[model samples]
Target: MTQPQDPQRSWPRFQTRKPRILLLTSQFFLLGEIRAACERLGVEHVLLDLQAKEMGLDDFVRTILGALTTFRPDFVLTVNHLGVDREGVLLQILEALDLPLASWFVDNPHLILPAYPRTHADKTLLFTWDADNIEPLRDMGYPNAEWLPLGTDVHRFAPGASGRPDWDADVSFVGNSMVAKVLGRYKAAAPGDELAAKIREIADAFGPADEPSAARFMLGRFPELRDAFLELESPARMLAFETLLTWQSTLDYRLDCVKRLLPFRPMIVGDKGWKDLLAEEENWRLHPEVSYYDELPGLYPRSKVNFNCTSLQMKGAVNQRVFDVPACGAFLITDRRRQMDRLFEPGSEVVTYADPEQIPELVERYLADPAARKAVAEAAQKRVLAEHTYDHRLEALMRTMRLTFEPAAQS
Candidate 1:
């Protein structure tokens, strides 16, 4: 009989033994998914919850170092650099110890990644959810920038799940009303009158354009704004302005998408921001936020059609809803994203609308055709189960890490 091939010969191992990972936990929704993925892969992990205790720099360093010494993990991982400090102490320590650190960004890296000072560490591997960001990240001098899209937990978000009747609806959207919060911040920290007016004007002109186009339009219209943004005087001012611009665009786009579905009487599950934003819309039903682990699993599968409006911050990337909705065996009508075509078969496994004008029509068509909706949902679920689960993601991540850090581990 022929000897069986070693699995390690096909796939590189991170270490001689099962790789131990130190997971820096935070309030981010993906924390649980990562933990579960590690469990399913039989990888040993230690969770260091940052929010559980308040720690100064010294305490933080001590705690992390203690964990490093005790757990002796091959790597330290976190979602979007949640537990990392702005001073880069954690990164410096990891670098000194020659430990591999992986930070997977599910959100816009431009906004969050810059906050970390030691982003260019050689041992640091930065994974972005958006493939469009890979070039930008490389341009930013990140040596190990990779495109790693988000995945769903198939077991948690599956079909025929029992959920509260209140959560069930013909059309449902689960996201935040970010406009109010973002605009409120901008208003409080408004630049001078001239700059503020220019900001408003540029924002008004930034309708329905992709990120690059919007940025170019704003720059073309108001060149001084770019100069002012780049000015070193009060960096916080520029950051706040950029945040406002991004959020304003997102809020406007999301509101427009939701408004298109007003005819469908969509149920919006999110924060009070939605209630305040659509206060006059009688057709929209707003529910309070649901816990990701406890409630969202049931809610996603229960809804007939789960809607996803990708945030403007993520232009080419699909949001978590794109994967989660399908994994739940529910039909998803998400705004068309360039990356969606690569992830799912458009109109078959998943549905997409390029314009807000098409949203209402698509919703109507899907609502009227239950068989079509069911077929697409089932197909999407199959695709998700087969290829887009966290297990697959974890395996890919490990492979990348091994190739980057331990190429010799491969036979």
Candidate 2:
């Protein structure tokens, strides 16, 4: 296959003899993605369901040793959390094992630092491009650390024919605005400012701002944004409701940062806690969240353009939607990220807005020019399928480990 430029020095190639994979994850949520990737690569994979069994530190270590003995995996893949206490048992096992290992750090690595082996692991995969993480990995003596953005299963999020004569607006967003606690973590106003700028840009693009700039903008050009925000009594009510529902869905503050942002859409499928939250919102057009791998490819195509917004921690990283939506050959309009241009050509493969303000106009432009939208989506789908598929990732990982062991094999 083609070599991945820069992020990692080269792509990992697949081997005829599938590598045995041992996946250790604290959350049950990821068990699906891990299984799918392994199945596609034909790798022998064993998943230790820590959440289901309520497995913790010492138990996890004993389990890893047992798996290594039984499965004889060539590599280990751990989720963000490594171990429970100091001199973590998992960390110890990794140090002793001759096999290579790596982690997909989907969470903020800084918050969970010190759980990782300071001087072990062949490589570490990051979700965002944070320069700060590099120094720590270097200090810890890891051989390699690089950003591998989060992705969605394209087959699961595929497009459906989402045309309904009675749909509310030409464009819509299923998300909330909760800024307080987000600021507490990053101490940055990018999220708030970006949201406001998106609104303003849409207004200016449509027409001159009047006394009620939002209302005037909506009344004239983007009636959708005005409709979405104005439906709530006030901004405070919107913010309060968002924070409250999020608390119900995610018991911990950590989960709230990511899970809470999802808009109150009837179609979103998640935990039972999520169903309870949706039940409270009578207006949402709720549907069961899909379970199978093939369902996603059917879902994303239903909308003209899907909306993606980022949390404070994920500002630098494109969410899974960035990859998944395009992979389905569905048109996507996403928030701006500095590195986005390098991955997919801007206004070509994917459409990006300078801020939320530009969303309406951008959406309008895409709707008006179906040819352009179709061309971009098709191009993106082709590019992502060629370079960014999970199989591509599996190949890259295997190739690296093979190279790491090549010298040893010769000796």
Candidate 3:
């Protein structure tokens, strides 16, 4: 079995010319950022839009093959195996052709990647946004798994972009309230009343801890529930249960945070699910979901402070908002994640709250001191421009590919 090259060794200039990359485009938000990075780095790329639901599986595979032959791309890239068929035909085809496949996972890979059969192809490289996931992925027999944190497209999400007055607010949050959707599915697929009760009990016991620890606590408290959960026998059923638990945790945290900031009348921008959560709260304004490209860039800059409450799905990792909000030159107050300390200087570049109780004090402090807020926002924006742009991420990705596979290909 092959291993990646030593980090100390100087990487060879693996590409003599601009490498043609075949981008398997999907509905994922990061697709545009990836494409932008390719363009910025002068990589010739073609997009085979896999998000077109109209295309059948056979047609999708044929179209990919057709694009590959016509474009003669040096590598194929996709977000979380979006273009790959359930039968693993795409991996088989790529393996037969000896073409390299790169799949970057921005979401929880464990929940989705396992569902995609045949992920162990030798020519495939798996990139995850979380450092915690690297070991698990490697444990799953993927030797090429690597840690590649998410990046923001600075060009798109930059400061001074024209923003509407109506969009401006003191504190703003942009995300969905996944409670209804997740719980609805969980209830529909629940095995039995006894099992459902046990699950609820576990959820109630779950605190502000990481997923792995919470899982252990649940199993420790009621060992029988572990077998009951496992006995469901359907991966989808397991996924639904896990997802509901995470969302329920998030729903509780988000509501608590927003309720604390209700006096300030923080703006909530996302889905109608929030309406169900905050039906009587007229002080807190709710807006329809904004487009990432069109609205978020402008809105971030306009708001004094952007509150980033990460989904419960991500434990150690910060969400896209952490990078995007700062790139837009906005002050952000986010919940502290273990990984955030490495990403930004807390209190200087980015502000954070350890718990809901601390949120109101932090918000009040920042809201009262405009100079301090501006200074921090500017510092964060500078940091993002210098280090956290998509171009930097893509360059690192290319370097990894070159180091790992280029030497073997050349030999």
> Which candidate achieves the best lDDT against the true structure?
1
lDDT by residue for model 3 over 1-411, one digit each (tens)?
122223333223345555567888656547778888888789888888767476666666677667876776777888877877776767766765667888888888876766777543667888888877788777777878888888898898888787888898998888888767666867745766666776556666664656533445566776878888787678777666766666666777678778888888988998898888899888898889988888889998878878888776677888899999889888899999888877899889889988889988998999999999999988999989988999988887777776667756558
Return whichever of 1 and 3 wins on lDDT.
Answer: 1
lDDT of 1 by residue, 243-327 (tens): 6777777787888889888998989998888877898889989888888767887898777888989887788888888888888
The alpha-carbon deviation from the true structure for residue 392 of candidate 2, after best TM-score superposition, in angstroms, is: 1.3
Return the candidate ranking by lDDT, descending: 1, 3, 2
Clashing pairs in 1: none
Clashing pairs in 3: none
Worst 10 residues of 3 by lDDT: 1-10
Q: For model 2, how does the per-residue alpha-carbon lDDT over 107-178 read when each residue is reduced to its tens digit?
A: 555545543335444434332344334555555566576655555555555455343333333333333333
On a 0 to 1 TM-score scale, where does candidate 3 land against the true structure?
A: 0.89
RMSD of 1: 6.8
Superposition-based RMSD of candidate 2 using all C-alpha atoms, in angstroms: 13.4
Q: Write down the lDDT of every candidate, Cα atoms only.
A: 0.79, 0.53, 0.77
List the candidate 3 regions with Cα displacement exceeding 4 Å: 1-18, 54-58, 204-207, 212-221, 280-282, 408-411
